[model samples]
Target: MAGLELLSEQGFRLDGRRAGELRQLRARMGVFAQADGSAYLEQGNTKALAVVYGPHEVRGSRGKAGAAAGALVNCQYSLATFSTGERKRRPHGDRQGQELSLHLKQTFEAAILTQLYPRSQIDIYVQILQADGGNYCASVNAATLAVIDAGIPMRDYVCACSAGFIEDTPLADLNYVEETAGGPQLALALLPKSDQIALLEMNARLHEDHLERILQAASKACKDVHALLDQVVREHLQEVTALLGK
Candidate 1:
């Protein structure tokens, strides 16, 4: 708030986005030929790649392969050593990476129709090639697109977004500067059609009175993300169809 103005008097954010406005989103599916499914996405300055594999036999010990009643879901989240302004010592294997990986697994487990592939395993790996803000949110959205490209069954499309509350206004899709402002922020992942929440996380506490408004703002942002992702999927399908005819 001191070094940078998060919200100007005109209601524009540091990046010139209005309250509840998301950043520019560009995405493509099937970016990789070998993986079962792959996607690359850019949300403002943040870029991520997601690759999905398996829905086949488990790789490790059967005891750790999970229950036969449902498929095992595994996720790994990594940030490139140079993804941020400061270089990282390791791409992963750290405490933050481990936590994000667990969050991703839980989010996918709630969305993917795991029962159909009982005793099998599905692996999703998300890497942050560039970091702005909303790293977790971008990862979720990209992973969802990758899963769709892989032809995996799911209850609905999963979408995610991050929101920050300041000056009694909710700012959607915060950038690195806004995120570092030390304000109350919320991250959400949702199955838009069913309005089911796959994950919800909050950092810094907001007044209870403003919680609902922040949630609603984040939910709307997720729907906006879903629309963009759906369009990308449609375009990818059309291209695939055209290639098949050739």
Candidate 2:
């Protein structure tokens, strides 16, 4: 942040996008035939894949406690070793993965209507295929589609986005370079229809006055993401309907 200027004088970012603009979003559902539901999504250079299984009978002590209340929503979030330039052992077997998994669980637990599937378990597994920032957002978005494809009912679509503050401007959908610029970064998951937030996390500190601005940017980005994902779902359904009619 000291030596590098994250924003250009021309009001552009390193990726050539303007502040408050989101990266290109592309997604596909029903990626894996074997799984109950599966989806793959890419936002800029970051890619994520998610699969859903169950709504079947609950198993293990981990799910037993929640069995009486509602369906057990178990999630696993993993970043592939190849996802980043510098390869590490990976997060699936480590603490970071566990934390991410918990975050995802919390995010979905708020949106999904789990009460209908009492004594059952729904497992969501999401993995990052590429990393260029916004990993958590992409994972949540992809998993949301996977659960939808699985025929799981939820209150509304959960869309996620990331934001950063730079040069007194709030930037939406930060990339790897912006993320490394040592500025305040925010990640948000929202339920668009209800205008409700499922999860919100921020790293670094920003002026109290600017916090609301960044949140607005992030919220707008999430709503934009919801539009994209909703289009994908509608297209997928149309294709499925055409095939069934033939």
Candidate 3:
């Protein structure tokens, strides 16, 4: 790819992962006692934290209620000033952050069964501590675990992955270098068991012939992410159970 060193001669990616492999995923739910739900997740060097609150009565405007069936999902995505290699002046209110917040809201609104808690609001706040790449994916994955920890009912766990095409080869899980290389990049969020896509996005031009391969690669990567997330949730529950001696 132009301006990118996608694969080294050693057949390793910039992060040294074989094709179709994801970064190491580490996550913790209920990290904060104050928030109704909270989680911290690290995918390789990319780190993100999510806090969820409410499902209570609307806070600001009463007229904004679009549905009486359930709850309103409000999401705000922010990046820590030091999250990137170059420090950001503001945490949020930037164009990129605003767009990310909107995307997150849309993704969660699909997964969360909002109709169950009518007239209430669910706030999902995501903070990126480190941004190597795939910040949105990491945030969604972390938030899903947090929502589950809070015992919120949802359609399914939202697992996300980013894929890139390098030198005509579709690669799963793109890191910073691969992403910046300027090739077609695809981001997908899938409900693993259902094999349904909640969010599908792409940047740059990709041929139709490569679309299926790229989608398949992303889907498989999402499934792998789901497995890792499941393990994290189970481990957290085990710890909680041990503490309770149950």
Q: What's model 2's overall lDDT?
A: 0.93
Score each candidate by Cα lDDT. Answer: 0.93, 0.93, 0.87
Candidate 2 is scored at a TM of 0.97
Model 2: ten consecutive residues of lowest lDDT: 87-96
Positional deviation of 79 in candidate 1, in angstroms?
Answer: 0.4
- What are the C-alpha RMSDs, in order, of all predicted structures? 1.2, 1.2, 1.7
Q: For model 2, how does the per-residue alpha-carbon lDDT over 1-29 read when each residue is reduced to its tens digit?
A: 57777789999888889998999999999
What is the per-residue lDDT of model 1 for residues 15-54, given as tens digits with 9 covering 90 to 100? 7889989999999999999999999999999999999998
Report how far residue 136 has shifted in candidate 3, in Å: 0.6
Listed in order, each prediction's TM-score against the native is 0.97, 0.97, 0.95
Model 2: how far is 58 from its true place, Å?
1.0
**Deviation in Å, model 2, residue 153 alpha carbon:** 0.4
- Model 3 misplaced stretches (Cα beyond 4 Å): 1-4, 62-64
Clashing pairs for model 1 are: none
Off by over 4 Å in 1: 1-3, 62-65
